[model samples]
Target: MSTQKKAIVFLADGAEEMEFTISVDVLRRAKINVTVVGVSLKNDYATCSRGVKIIPDVKLERNTFKAEDYDALIVPGGAGGAKTLAEHETIQKLVMEFYEKKKIIAFVCAGTLVAKAAGVPHKHKVTSYPAGVREQLVNVYNYSEDRVVVDENVITSRGPGTTFLFALTIVENLIDVETSNTLRKEMLTHENL
Candidate 1:
């Protein structure tokens, strides 16, 4: 049987380009099977916050996407994308199912807000984009200013600037520290400013 770890990243209109792409790129490089799912009712391409258009591997459908099939769930944040994800009932249900199954759930920037709206059990150490985002998560979680915070199955990060670390953290969780470090060095991520 194949032992590859599988991950699913949910994308919505206005998703932060860096956050969504970086996470998927890093995971794929680590040999993890990453599926990009566009969470839209229309089943079309998702437009990023910076205006980059990406066609997802599949469109998220209520009965089609199963949480148990993947090892992790990723949500990349942009103000509009996060809001859309938070308000999407199908996405919320998937988040809850992932949480219940104890699978890794990673969120970046405003993406963490979707977890809040999904009602994933709170009090975990988490971080997200500051500005208008921190206030909402601070009271609900053991919030931090760290670039990446991993508490059990939930992993979160700050914003675009922190996407590398966030994605690397997910790699470490789904794979191993050795693999994560290898990719970090190969990508010269350790030398980033």
Candidate 2:
């Protein structure tokens, strides 16, 4: 078999540990290459909200994502990480590049803010953790208000409570459902999601 395709998880100072790791881990377990990218303010390793420091796989200046390098962009939610990512000019540019090129964009938890800042316009439906940042996304429909809202190339989920669902949803987008289902079983996570 060929080597798995890759997805990138953008991180920064204060990335919520679980959101960051679980997102990357789920994709990895599904046999996709997950690249954890730490967009540090100091241009070095980023310290997670839980205190785990991670060295990014590539730097802002060195990334050759090209909108065709692999598959998707994953943004995990954390108050600090989201805040940092939202404020970074390079990240904004990269994300905009991703969006303009129609790459799959996945955000969970607070990561929605980052995506919104990159100009997703909230066109379809979206969900976010805590529900306070709805303003960032111009036209959002709460999933809990009804069903899981997936629009075009964008995917958003609530919070830690919805992380598993978020991961599976992303997998379904990046690859095949059979692969996603097999990995879901291996992780012992609900496929009903």
Candidate 3:
């Protein structure tokens, strides 16, 4: 039997391109199976924050995706995308289900706001985009200014610049530190970052 880990990335309109793309890229490089799910009911593609349109591998719907099927759930950030994710009832329920299943729930930049809306306990330490976004989550979570913060199965990171580390961190959690380190070296990310 194959032991490869599977992850699902939720994509909405205005998602941060780098966060979405890099997370998928790095996770695939680590040999993880990544399924991109479009949160939009209107189309199969999500128009990113910078106008990059990407067609997801699947559309999130009842009986289509489940928390038990994947090792992690990833949410990328953009102002509009985060708002959409935070407001979507199905997405919120999925977040809770992932939490209940003890699966990794990873968010980047403003995407961290979705955790607050989804009723994730506020005691966990987390970080987000440091400007206006941080203020909203400060009173709710044990907010930090660190580039990446991992509190148990929940992982959060800053903005686009921290995406590589954020994705690598997820890889570490799903696989192991040794695999993550090897990818870092192979990608020449070890010397650059």
Q: Give me the candidate number with maximum TM-score.
A: 3
TM-score of model 3 relative to the true fold?
A: 0.96
Please estimate how well model 3 matches the true structure, expressed as its whole-model Cα lDDT.
0.92
Better of 1 and 3 by TM-score: 3
Candidate 3 Cα misplacement greater than 4 A, ranges: none
Indicate whether candidate 1 or candidate 2 has the larger TM-score: 1
RMSD of 3: 1.4
Cα lDDT tens digits, model 1, 119-139, are: 988868999999999999999
Worst 10 residues of 1 by lDDT: 59-68
lDDT of each: 0.91, 0.76, 0.92
Question: Where is model 1 more than 4 Å wrong at Cα?
Answer: 41-43
* TM-score to native of every candidate shown: 0.95, 0.86, 0.96
- The residue pairs in collision within model 1 are none
Clashing pairs in 2: none
1-193 per-residue lDDT for model 3 (tens digits): 2598999998899999999999999999999999988886456688899999999987776347788889999999999899999999989999989988999999999999999899999989999999879999999999899999999999999999999999999999999999899989988889866
Q: What is candidate 2's lDDT per residue for 79-156, written digit by digit as tens? A: 899998888887777777777777888888788888767766645577777566655554454343322346788888
